[model samples]
Target: MLVTLEGLDGSGKTTVWERLRSDDMVPDETVFTREPTDTWYGDAVQRSIDDDDADSLAELFLYTADHAAHLSNTVRPALEENRLVVSDRYSDSRYAYQGATLADSEMLDDPLSYVREVHAPWTRPPDRTVYLDLDPETAAKRSGATNKFETADYLATVRDNYERLIEADPERFVRVDATADPDTVYERVRDAIV
Candidate 1:
């Protein structure tokens, strides 16, 4: 089974993934991974992220490349072995964050749709997704507004894209409020997973 944890940068999905790694509740052989993976492709994506003036289309493709590498190198092999796969972020991150980034450009009529279409052909769909929900202001604060994507205004647009994704595939996603205390949020996420 493939499960993905998704939300804004500071929504605690990464924290939850870390906790899950040490928890006895989750399967011992479960594979936990993330995107922009710790690879050369991801390195390029990180570089683009730090460059505020980076071309939106270029950044999107960089992220897409990292995700593709993540699948081929890690996610696919684990799933082929029938191991439980839990990823901190997946293609949905591209659909949300990159879609928001490209919103102002005249490149595509619907950025979110365009992002999804780009991934639709080869991406492996998660069996379930735990979406940690938080307001944009709070998310920005928690994330420290460290990067262009962490800004409240940009996060708000990203949040909207997430909502659209959840609406389109309600059955695959479970929403967990991220405004609660860390323990509470983590518990809810773990519960949603197992």
Candidate 2:
């Protein structure tokens, strides 16, 4: 099972992942990994994140490269061995973040479709995705970074993109109200996945 937790930074994904990891129900073979993986491509993506002038398309491609490397090096191997895989972020982040940022650019008519099309060839979608929904103001406050995509307005657009992705395939997502305490949020995520 490839389970992924998706939300804005400081939306408690790490906290929830820790709780899930410590829970007794999780299998021993479960392998935990995250995007912007520990690779050259991932390094590029991280660097690009802090670059104010970075092109949206460049960021998208960087993320895509990191994703491909992460899948081949981590996710696929774990799955091949019959172990469950839990990831921090995945295709949805690409669609949400990049789609929102690219929306105003002359890159493509539909940034969402462009992202989706680019990722169509990647194998294995998450068995389940938990989207911790929170207002942009709260999420922004929770996250202290002042990176290019950390603004409230940008996050709001990203949330809208996330909503569209969820609407496009409702069954694949478990929406959780993330304004509650960390333990409470984990409870929702636990319930959703269990």
Candidate 3:
């Protein structure tokens, strides 16, 4: 089973994923990973994230390359061996974040759809996705507004994209409120997964 944890930065995705990875409740052989992965492709993505003037389209491709490499190098093999796979962030993040980035560019009339279509043919869809729900302002504050992607205004657009994703595939997404205390949020995420 491929279970993905997704949300805006500081929505507690990495924190929850870390705890879940160590929790006794999960399977011992479960495979935990994230994207952009810890590869050179990921390094490039990180650089792009730091570049305030990076082209939206270029950034999207960087994310796509990382996802492809991640699948080939990790996700596919783990699933083939019947291990439970959990990712902190996956393709959805690209679709949401990059979609928002390109929204005002006028290069693509439907940025979200375009991003999804780019990955539709090759990406492996998660069996389930846990969306940590939080307001954009709170998410920005929690994330420290560190980069272009962490701002409240931008996160709001990303949130809208996420909502569209959920609406399109309601069955695959499990929504969890992130406003609760850390322990409560962790418990909720654990329950949703287990």
Candidate 4:
């Protein structure tokens, strides 16, 4: 099974992933990856973040490249071996953040459709997508001002997009309230998968 955690910055995805790994709730054979993964492409994404670059399109392409490399080198092989794969973030984030950035740009008419047509075909969707829901204010407080993309306003829009994504595909997506305790959220995730 391939499980992915999706949420706004500071929604506790990294914490949850670490907890799951430490607890061995994530299978030993399971491979864990995150977007802006530790690759050259990922490094570029990180640089973009650090520089506070407004080139949303460049960031989007970097993320796409990272996803493609991650899938080809890691996720797909693990799946082929029948090992569960858990990812902290995936393609959905691109559709949310990049799409939001491109909302008013005449170039991005239908961001989802564009992503689906251009990038979706190259990647695999997760078996289950877990969205850790939290309010923008709370998310910002938790996240701090580390990344350029972690703004409260942007996260609010990302959260809304996540909700819409979930609503469109209820069967594959699970929304969990991250405002609760970590254990509570972990239990919910465990229950959902098992």
Cα-based lDDT for every prediction: 0.93, 0.87, 0.94, 0.82
Whole-model lDDT for model 3 versus the true structure? 0.94
Q: Could you tell me every candidate's TM-score relative to the true structure? A: 0.98, 0.95, 0.98, 0.94
Estimate, for each residue in 142-180, the C-alpha lDDT of model 2 and write its tens digit. 887567777788999999999998999899999999999
TM-score-superior candidate, 1 or 4? 1
Which candidate leads in lDDT?
Answer: 3
Clashing pairs in 4: none
- Count backbone overlaps in model 2: 0
CA deviation > 4 Å runs, candidate 4: none
lDDT (10s digit) by residue, model 4, range 1-194 = 88999998899999988877766555677777788798888887788778775577776787788889999988999999998888999988887777777676788778765765777556788899998899988898899958877788888787777877887789999989999998999899767765
Candidate 4, residue 67: lDDT: 88
Candidate 1, TM-score vs. the true structure? 0.98
Which of candidates 1 and 3 reaches a greater lDDT? Answer: 3
lDDT of 1 by residue, 113-169 (tens): 999999999999999999999999999999998888898999999999999999999
